[model samples]
Target: MSSQTLNKIPLISLVGPPNSGKTTLFNYLSGKKFKTVNYPGSTVEYSISKILSKHAVNADILDSPGIISLIPSSPDEQLSVNTLYSHPKFGKPDIVAVTVDVSQLSRHLYLVKQLLESNFKVVVVLTMTDVLYKKGFDISENKLSSILNCKVVRVNGKTGKGIDSLLTVLKESLNEIEKDSAASLIKADKHHKTKLLESYSEIEKIEKEVLFETDQKSTNGKIDIQKINESIVVLNSAPKFLKADETSLKIDKFILHKFWGLIIFFLIMALTFTSIFWLAAPLMDLVNDGFSFLSENAFTLLGEGLIADLIANGLISGLGSVLVFLPQILILFLILGLLEDSGYLARGAMLIDKPLSKIGLNGKSFVPLLSGFACAIPAMMATRTITNKRERFLTIFIIPLMSCSARLPVYALLIAFLIPQETPWIGGLLLAAIYVFSITSSIIIAAIVNKFSNRLVKEKDNTSFILELPAYRMPKPMRVIQETIKNGKQYVVKAGPVILFLSLLIWILTTFPNYDPVVPVSPDVSPEQTEILKSNERMSTSYAAYLGKFIEPVMAPLGLDWRVGVSLIATFAAREVFVSSMALIFKITEEGDDMQNSILNSMREAKIGDSDQKLFTTATTAGLIVFFVFALQCLSTVAIAKKETGSWRIPVLQVVVFTALAYVFAFVTVNGLRAFGVN
Candidate 1:
């Protein structure tokens, strides 16, 4: 092969087990700041960046989703495995870079062995050498390299230590392969029929040759023990000597204590909810005022016409309803990112493992379930860590019930309206209660699903939960802030367009058919009342009102009128759109009033037909909260669920089952509360 042909844009892939600092190395090599965290399954999707290495020009580096083995299990693992050979878009990578945690060498080497057997040009990057030294194990890269017949480089991904040497080794290895093209081609040909049993035997041989126990207490204290491939081995000075850091052990003792841990967990969660309200309040108010100003000024400039209504009522007011909650969304992710980056999230998962197992999941499932509170899309993707197919699907099924941040706008709006802001503590407690209720409901539903799924699928449960708790470290503030902003931006990018489209559709539906009121304009009636009457007359014959009436029969049982029914339909696009839809509808009804004032006052004063009874009573608000909690309203979530599961049936079933549960629970809650004289 010619040098020119061998130098064709080199593609390098980074692959590793979860939380092994694979992405950190990718950032170092590519000089890009992709998000990294202490927990597993953080990289739900792959990232590609142009490599900036001096030795390797025109190189494109791909950071694939983390995987435990080449034998694919979850969607993420499958993607990683597929990327190694012939990715449809990325093509086959010229070289594979495997990151192995030296502290957990025995476990990490399993994937490396598989990669070697597959005949790919592989380089093993040993991460966490300092961590390995802390654990009292000294690893020799040269020894491991000789045993595995591959190049090994040790580097600290965070500090950029030894990165230049690794790149140099990669360039040397590529040149060596190019020189021995005939042998390389021959080795590639043999990989097609590589035997797994043979590979496993070779891995066992390599493990014995390169790994050793360090003990100083007794004569010949390093005596060999039975080979344990599944569990991690912690080297110590003696058989009984504890290897864990004293500080971490002490912290875990209190934080992982069952009773205390549960209490502390709830307290932390309560604080998080409280902070969302307290921290985001001023920013939310600013956003609200800004949008209100835009709406008023645009109305004045455009004058009374469809264009003004479109710009002010349809666009500004609708977008404002969702935008006002962006600060809260940012805060939620910021808090979660801190928890995850501090390595406490894994300990929390460990604390909840027993309870989760009773519901047919384990600590691994808890991370994804916890993430569902931020967003179900990524939460669903985070289930890639659950190797068991049954447990992964079950976790995905209940994630939407966890009350994601998208529901924050609706919850905050309704809760504020329902409970006075003067009693903020009460509102905060109510908000926390909603989250607690969501978790409790998810557990119950998961338990029910587990019972039935066992009878339906009948697969043996061979997968065991094994969680590796990372060393505690301070979270990088810049990274956390960047990730939080990225998440908030994603919400805008994904839901913004849909909300704008729906707002316009709703505006048109309520605006047209040109119904001039048959009754003469009474001189005694105020202009606001006249506009309200005109709106009522027009909406009575408009398409949106027709949709509302069509769905009202179903919604009326939950104490919602046709207007609320219209908003509910719009929520199918996104849970937050419920607020925006209501804002637009109410703004259209009461013209010439401040948009903010019109929405709040209109909702408060709204009443049922032929009666003065308010529509948004305590019972109605509670029902709506319950409905939003259970309903799988986000279309993006459904699409992702379908894509992940590779079947439309699961997504369809999710929607049908969750929507029905929402309606039934809402109906029962509303009627039951009213019957108890709570309304």
Candidate 2:
């Protein structure tokens, strides 16, 4: 065959097993920083981008999902394997870059051998060499490359070590493929039909060949060790990163113990959840102050007209309320990201797997469930990583009960009134109790749903959990901050507009029919008192109040009145709006520390309709807390569920089922508590 330069740009496909740092390498080559998740199936779809590394030849690179073999075991694996062939849009790949984790070199090379036999140009990229080396095992790149009949390069994706060398090899491979472009493209067009090597003993033999010990003793390719050592590695790679890994091994030992592990996991979770409250308070206040400043400026600039009031109260305040959650969102993901990068999260998943399995989910569902504590929108997106459709749908269905950060304000406000401020620990304890109750209820409900769903729908769900833990490494501060900021932006982008529109709608609903900008106030009162009275009068006569009165009878069963009905309606757009709606109901514009105290005082003094008794009774507040825990209040979550499931039936079912459950549980709680004479 005559050699010729191709007219089209060369294509390269990146393939690797999960947690092999493949996405990190892809980010380097493509000049695109896609999130590198530590768990499997995060890269559920392929990402294509232009080759931007100066050392590499100009080409288009496709980063595919992690796969163990050419023969697919799951949907995501099939997507990865399919891209090795020539595509109508992608053309033929000049080279397939297989990222081989040196720690598990032998197993990774099986895929390399398969590609080599298929007559495709394959380059074995040795990553995590340091990870293996720290475990006292090192590889001979020349020895391994000679056996595989392909060029091999070791690269550190995080440090940019050996990346240029790897890129140069890709350049050479691209040139070699160009020599026989026509024939190569023809070969690439056909799919891989026969299965690849499946023999474990054969792989183990090869594992022994190229691996050596730093201290002159080697476990070879697979890290075989004493029972304790094997247990250490199994938990997460207990690398000899000095005495630190030794400490990790000891700590992991205790954490994996049957009794201590539960205590440890709960402590870790409590720390994570509590950080969302205390750690985010100062930053949340800053965000609130920032928005309040903007709202004031908007009102000042436009003067006291409907437009100014709408822009300030409806638009700015609306966005401010939802966006105030940005700090908590960032903090939550930051802590979780650090935990993931440190390898502890893998153990956390494993620890939780037993209970989850009882409810028909595996460790894979933990990430999404944990993420739901931040927001259901991203939590729902995280479900894509779950390969099983049923598990993903079920995870999404139960996510609302996780009590996301959106409900934090509602909880904080209600808890403030429910528990006296003088006894702060009681409030804290009660708050913690609510979260505990919610999580427990979710587990129970999930088990019930799983049982009933199995009877109604018969689908083959035989997929078992396969988790490969990465070596524990110190989390990079930059990576944690970057991921947190990325997720914060996503939260804002997803929920911002929805909040804005609904805020405008709610303002309109509470302002009109008569549409009066001003209401009569007592001339003898102070300015603040006059403004408060006018605000109260305006709300009392507004269209929202009329609707609230209409729905009051339905809500009364749970001991809630017209005001709570209006607030609940407002939160449907975004759950965080419940706080803002409550603030409006109480004649407050913001939920900062100073204003929160004022709102609490107002709520304490509040009466139901013409009655002299308090409205926010302890029993009613407890019922409200329980209601928020189970209710599908966030429409954004519903929309995302619709998007992920591709069915209206599921999302509708989620809303109906959760709302009914919330009503029932809340009614029971309120009545039950009153029967116990707690109030």
Candidate 3:
């Protein structure tokens, strides 16, 4: 917003401790789908949107990152602290909403107390009140408000229990807090840093008076709560000895068990990947046939020209290759969103924290690393949660090694050449092995980098891995669906156009300088054979072929010809483009439903340069698979890495190193497999 715009409307800044349901309340108030994963550091950056609500107020809401104290330790915290101090560009907020999880009120209110003492209008927004009984406590919101000298409201994010009341109070408070254009947010005297541990006593003393014991039937034989939002009463009447009421604690026991947790984590992943194939297969076929029908109609209508070929092969065919994977993308995001909201995502991180730390990585790296499997761009963004600069950079460097969904199309196409589609389970197993290998290789690389980093960087990065685990809750249906659709739209709107442009570029290069079918009539050659000769002659002399042959020398060691070599270069624009490039290169214009199968068969029958040897032997196919798994191909991922790290040097070096290593690995694989008599 401009300075004039900021001067007229009021700004309300939402600040709270991590995982305190601050973003959820922002979602309910603003009606935007900013992701709310059930862990700390989910909101690495702040979000701003016009207040979309029923209250008759013209204002903007700035959702800042969670901060424990006014003093900051990490980059993510510093960014939020910058806005709290009212950066000149963002302007000052009229009132600050400090969200606190009632279950962990004693720990969360430290920030609220600090904001109050800093001479800012503070409203204590209470979330997760449903889990009060689970935590063996109940809180009086009115008492806490009076004690803290601030307004308090209890709201349930899932149910929208008291959202209206919260908004109404915020509008009133906006007027009461006098407007200020002061450059500095904190007008009090300058101070020294007192660690969060020092404030524990004062925070607990205030908590004990307002928060009552939930284990007892009645606190001193009297039970009553003030009428703020009517959510202060005890939720569960059961007498419980455990910390969390019952179900969550029991569920946590097995999922968090040392031995069982590993099994459960792997089982969950196995089920997730199985569902991606079994569930999305039919949807993929539907999309494929739909595009095929469109292409056929377009071919008939346009009727044999460059426009027709561009529409049928370049546009429809190329888009179909990538869009066929949309179902799998949506399913992947849906399952991930469910995992995040159900709180199992955080536990999975905790369960594997020890093993990750053994490799000089933090548990905080788990979320970002898991996100890397979807797409490296967002995965690198998720690394903001890592507090230490050294660790965060290490996490970003290895993220590209994780096989993202963009590689799925490439993997699926090549695996068909190795394993028959008849025994699909074997192909599935092979696919699973690729994912496992990618993760294992990444861990090994991280270990080596960590060792070298420790020796090079003299200053010790002693930042501890601190995370607040959210209690297990049922994943909300609407939230999961919304997140899935949002991500699906993002992939289509952002990556779709790039894929189309590159596909068209490949088509133009392959189709130009047409070779006229002026072959001399031979008695032995049939009409079909003559037509095939004409098509092959035209393709061999095309621009793409010349480019492919130029790179053929480099690819010769892997037993690959110009056709396969060209596709390896094309996929770097975006990994899914490999299938489209191969489709266009092989002239598989009619992709009815077996587009991939057609490509696979053509690749099987393909011959090496002037030789009878098959191009796609087992050794060559395995080499290509390894090359794709380890290569840093996507430009978007590289751009994000630079933006996140604020250095072009790192991303440029990352691309060079991974690409070179991939070539060496592929070279080793092909020769080693050939030595084993596999071909």
Candidate 4:
């Protein structure tokens, strides 16, 4: 068949087993950069890319979930099936690109056989062909193509070898659109009928002619399997290898050695929180200052009314709120990435299994729970890794309680306001205490929920923590850079646009219909009296005023006035937006035209209530701290829950439960402090 020009092609779905370089090919074809996690099920969902052919036709290419077999008992396998049979959006694919690892042809061919049976126009894409010669294996591509009744294109997704030829084959196949007759010859039935028997016989003939046997074991493959087996065996051993490896100074010794491991874990956690607080502070201030400068300059250059205020308040402050925390987010991910790539995270999971077991969570729950700290959505998605349904659900349920980095801005702002920074250790202690509180509360809640729920716990004496600690090779520079770039891009792509819009919206709220009420400047009038009237006027007519009033009574017991309440409400959109909200409000309320100094001065003098009391009193600040500490105050988390659970009921319940607890706790803390005369 003559090749059709690339510019006029249809969709091609790339399917393969885990880690078979399917993603690499997708990246090459579509130019879409996807992060590759060091696990089998990295590509949980499908992603599409457009491959521009030399002739100008752009081909729609899809990279799908990794599946070991069509007959799947796991969620990942089921997801693959859904992708194949049901095109929820665009209907069925026009073509299928089946990737097979050349070295692991025997296992890889099983999936190819299944895909061929599905009746899609199959073009076999042989990936990792270099591994074949290295591993002393051989496959006759021409012979295999004849036997399977499909064109075989040898391509290396990694090295880009023979990619153009493969693309040409795809073009040729499109022109013909010939469905292989061999497809209808295989069925999923247990017993072989005439069609199935014929398909098997054909496959056997192809295997005999095309494949040459190899005696050499794959250096990486054997090591990986051996490590997995040893780790699993060690986990279930009678005496346990918990002490360490043969070095007498075992790696797991301090990492998972019960008492020492627990201590180190706590210390690592404490240091993580402390580092977030200290490192993020200076960067946050710089961002705030930078935004303030820009807002003031805009107001000065663009004049004093709506547009100026919008640029100053809405655009500058709102966007600044989200941007200020990027440093912290980067740092958090850096540490996490290192831990993950170094292969210590799984070991950490094993270390915590005994403690998790006490809460009706199995060892598998550790992966999800630890993942929750980064992002509850991914954490919830990770529940699929748990074999036990009860454990999976429990992990998802409790994941939101962990303080994801989104909540960091809210916590930092409130803590800095309420707690005295003069006492560094004291402030540090309080900050660390909050994380401890979060952990304690999550476990207790999980335990209570477990007791009430009737989810059956399947008991099996056979259990293991089998994981491959890939050789401690120096972390690949290109791989790390690639991942960081990929993750950073996703962050911007997924969360950036929403934040940009929200920032502009917030600026508009504070700046529009500017009310500049004149205060009498008589020498006889006291400064306090003048300040009081001006503050009242600002509060009555400002956008924050209207919002704060709506939630005033609900949070009255916590000593929050309309301003703080308004800030809290704004943050419900995204918790890290709190700082920007505060900055915006201050920009609107500033007496002078300068937004930066205006906000700083406003925050500095912010007091409690009427009667000469401050608006940002110690009690209210403490209350806000406690509230953020326990609140499930992130939309992203909720969205993630919905995605993971495949339902809204669980996420809704989480919102209600976490918010109620946060309010109650804050109210008690505030009132208790008042009663004790701490103010």
Candidate 5:
């Protein structure tokens, strides 16, 4: 914590639009990389990185959220604004580097102008210069700098051009930066702080002196999307029917076209989901196996004691649970990025708008709910975009019901263990059933909540949805590589510390009482089996076991014993935790320990029904599956909901409702399946 002992890092903020190559530049600047988290209010977060500059400056270069305007509407935009205006507790950024794309210069200039007016001593990093070069546009750098009254460094973050110059400029600017006079001209009004609009006269005067063009074609012939802006004003003021009619007419030909558009929409989502499952499977297997191996080695090296148990059971198993899901997490983010960058995501929202409206939720709900597949934390965070209190609350309330990526591991583990690969249809059907149940139940719950809650009653005025689709550019290889690393690494850094501690705690709980007092045994047995037996009993004596016992009575009718009960609780932390927790309880100690054999052996050996029958009948497994599918099993989600809603009420409601429904459903499923002799 001591600054004197710490590295004196010079922080630099990189700001830009989506796909502006700002992140690319940050990756090059700092050896570190970042992943996209949806802007704070949205489910997706952008990636960022930091590295030591060649100037011997420890540069913490931040890849900021994309912003379209200074007047913030999205969480990303607001975050960018906040980062710029506020000083971090450590210190203020030494330099602000605003990177802009040449193709989208007009839109990109909005942020640049605002930064200039904010009195921040800024260095302009002009990225995507290669695109400008290819397009035959030429401008004198000196002239451009004079026009803007600031130093402009034209650089390609990709090819490393002008990077050195930009760095030198940054170092110099950090020494004697002065506040620009233009800062006084723009008002800090939320409604309209169009810096470009306010500075147009000065911009025009400067342009005449500095601007030059080569064989570049005039951009005026390109479609002017400004009309869509005017349409939003009219739509916002119009009645619901008129607004609906206008929007439906605008999109009907394409969205609901008899030809390819609808087909394409469906294909995109289908492909995305399929890709997530396919790409992550092998990596997930590796994570699971690797963690198991690490745990065994640690336990073997450390010997039989509290720290060993902590390392093995608490740290290794718990961390393994979190780590196993990283691949899926990365795949989900990558797909989301592709969708967003390709411009298909907004269209998907529009495509589902009409249907979602019929369900009493807005089309915007689709994005958040679909995002739930990645992590419900961000799904709940996304409710800010909902605008309506009732709709927002409704979305937040039902989001946990969706099968989040955490749940995917649980489902995968369970289905693979119980259902055969040859009968994949059965497993697929179960997965699909859970999804269907979630969507249907969400709609029903939203309708019921809407009846009692006072929803925003204003007619939709903002109805026309003509989004600017970025050209179908192949997702840049460098961008994808940077993104994959950022998200993948954070999974370890952000979640790793917590899981490590949890693992230590679990180890302590499961490895105490070296000798078993409950069931007396002869002293002739070998040490290893004796240790395993004692460890097993100690597990029963652990605090986690007591917790399971406390919840067991409530869950008993649903067919779960204390072991299963403990796992269900662990899952609330993260669903994948259930696997490692179960592995710990059963005292299995090897990576790639045949999960199917382990589960079957443990369950078959478990006593029930007057010492003859096995405890884990098919009905019981079915009940467990049903419970996981229906239950709200993520703490991160509830935390995020609390953050987003500015209340504990909705997340509390979600926890209670989902828990109750899961119990009831499991109870019925176990009893009914048994009664029908299906088990």
Candidate 6:
């Protein structure tokens, strides 16, 4: 078999245990911006991209979910294993590029051995070698390669060190695999059916051949620490006795202290939320100004017809309402990514585990819950790490309460209208307080659910909390920027088209059934006032107003008028649609040549029916925020929930319960504020 005889695009799989820098390597090789986190189970699905190699052979590379072994313990692990041998979409890979963390060679070798024994073409790429070397333990890649009878190359995914060498080695290994008919060097028949004990025995034999250490201990008549150390040859410069990681230990002393850790976590989260407003303000202003310029030009060029209105008001203003918040979204992801890459996020999980376990979830659930702030979809997917069915279900059920980035646009709109700009810090504090309220509400709901659900399903006490805290290193700036841009672009790509269409739809619905104003014109009435009256009269008779009126009775208790009701109905598609819908509705209602007149001003001036009072009172704004915080309005989330749960019942139940709760809370908030004379 020659290279030309095989397929043109060779499939290369980068497989490794969790947090072995496999994703970083994948990103480097493929020139793609997949997320890289310092925690386990981050890569839940396989990402396939073309390898940007200068070699003659072009390859399609896959970064699979991290697995400890072929036998799966969780859904992510199962997916990874299935992709390796029997994926429904992508069949088994041609070559398995095993990424080995040099610091944890003994544990990682077990998977390498399994791959070799299973007759998979394997090439070992050693990562974290520098970390291992810094800790006074360095193993020769050549010697390790000779012992394993495979091609081994050292590479740093972050710095691109040794990547060229690894590519050269990969080319040779691929050629060798082609010559050998894509077979493993060591041929063993029926190795896939090898017993667990036999596999361990085989792994032990290899471990003893390469590692070296002093004063190792054995437990339960199993392979001893001495044998594990003897599997790798330690460099002569290595310390005679391994020392504890003093810096991490000292930091952990305070960071993991029960009281201090909790306080620090809250402070960090508060800063993160506050920064979303303070830091993103300038960029948001720029985006707003940019859209304003574009809208003005469109209106000037196209003139005052339907096309001009559609482009300038419907599309530009509507999309801009959502796009201005992109800066905030990027900042949020950047801060979270820094925390994750620095290994502080895992510690935060550890600190919160005890309280979470009390509510029937372990520390593993914390990652998904934290991820909910970005979006509920991936957070729900991340719940696959929870092996306990009941815990996993509970995590999924409560995820939507965390107030994802979709809600950020709505929050920013309402907060800007409600909170004054002069008091920037006050606005930031309000933003932080919203997130705090969301978390508090989620915990209360979880507690109530845990209390009742435990009686129905027997609580499992065997589930343990085991977390790995990677060495805290400076976050790669380029990586942070890449992820920020990638995520921000995703928001635009996913939400932009839907929002534009809905905006256009809303414009049509509000513009039709145009009525001739019969009201007598007065000389005192300005043209702007006349235009406002005509627009309001037209909207009152329009199709959108009819639908809003139909729902107005139901929403009246929450201080929302028919216009707000219309936007709320549109938000069922996505929370961010609320902003665009409002933008379109207000654009039609207000008489302004400038599309840049803050939507906040129009909202403030908006009146409810014949009332002289403003529609967006403090009470109304507060109530809207409450409703959005609790409502499961996203149809995509509902669909994903149904798919993940394998039934419509759970998703339906969530929708009903959350919507009812949102109504009740919103009613209370508005009425309570009104009672306190907060107009």
- The count of residue-pair clashes in candidate 2 stands at 0
The C-alpha local distance difference test score for the whole of candidate 3 amounts to 0.77
lDDT for each residue of candidate 5 in 326-426, tens digit (9 for 90 to 100): 78878877777666554556667767777766656666777788767777766666655554555566777778877777777777766765676579668
For residue 220, model 2's alpha carbon misses the true position, in angstroms, by: 20
Model 1: per-residue Cα lDDT over 348-400, one tens digit each: 77777788888887677877876777677778878887778777788888889
Worst 10 residues of 1 by lDDT: 229-238
Give candidate 5's error at residue 575 in angstroms.
Answer: 2.6
| Each prediction's RMSD to truth | 5.8, 6.1, 5.0, 7.5, 7.6, 6.0
Query: Over the stretch 435-520, how does candidate 3's per-residue lDDT look in tens digits?
Result: 88988899898898778765423446585777766777788888778767867777777788888888888888888777364666
> What is the number of residue pairs that collide in model 4?
10
lDDT of 6 at 393: 80
TM-score of model number 4: 0.76
Superposed model 2: Cα runs more than 4 Å off: 1-11, 30-57, 78-94, 116-121, 134-147, 175-179, 182-252, 293-303, 384-392, 461-463, 517-537, 589-593, 610-613, 676-679
Clashing pairs in 6: 207-231, 210-231, 210-232, 211-229, 211-230, 211-231, 211-232, 212-229, 212-230
Which should have the higher TM-score, number 1 or number 5?
1
Residue-by-residue lDDT tens digits, candidate 6, 1-679: 2432444667788899887888788887888634332222377767887777553447778887888887776777777887787446445567889998866776688789888877787899999876665554566777788878888889987678988888887778777756666552343233455575676666555544554442223434676556456434333333223334557778887788878887888898778766776787778778767877887788779876678877877788777866876787778778877887777877887887888989877777888887678778777888887777678788899999987877876887788878776886676678778988988998999889888766534656557766677666787788777766776776677667876677777878877777455555999999778777877777778899999999999978887789999999888877777876776677532334333345787887788889886889999999999999999988878988888777786688889989998999999999999999997
lDDT score for residue 249 of model 4: 38
Highest TM-score, which number? 3
Minimum summed lDDT over a 10-residue window in model 5 is located at 238-247
Leading candidate by lDDT: 3
Per-residue lDDT of candidate 4, residues 78-170 (tens digit): 766666654565445567788887656666787778777666678888877665654344678998898778889998755688888888888
Q: How many backbone clashes does candidate 1 have?
A: 0
lDDT of 2 at 302: 90
> Which digits, one per residue and each the tens of the lDDT, describe model 2 over residues 502-535?
8778878776764554755566778766666667
Query: After aligning candidate 1 to the native by TM-score, how far in Å is the CA of 649 from where it should be?
Result: 3.1
Report residue 392 deviation for candidate 1 (angstroms): 1.5
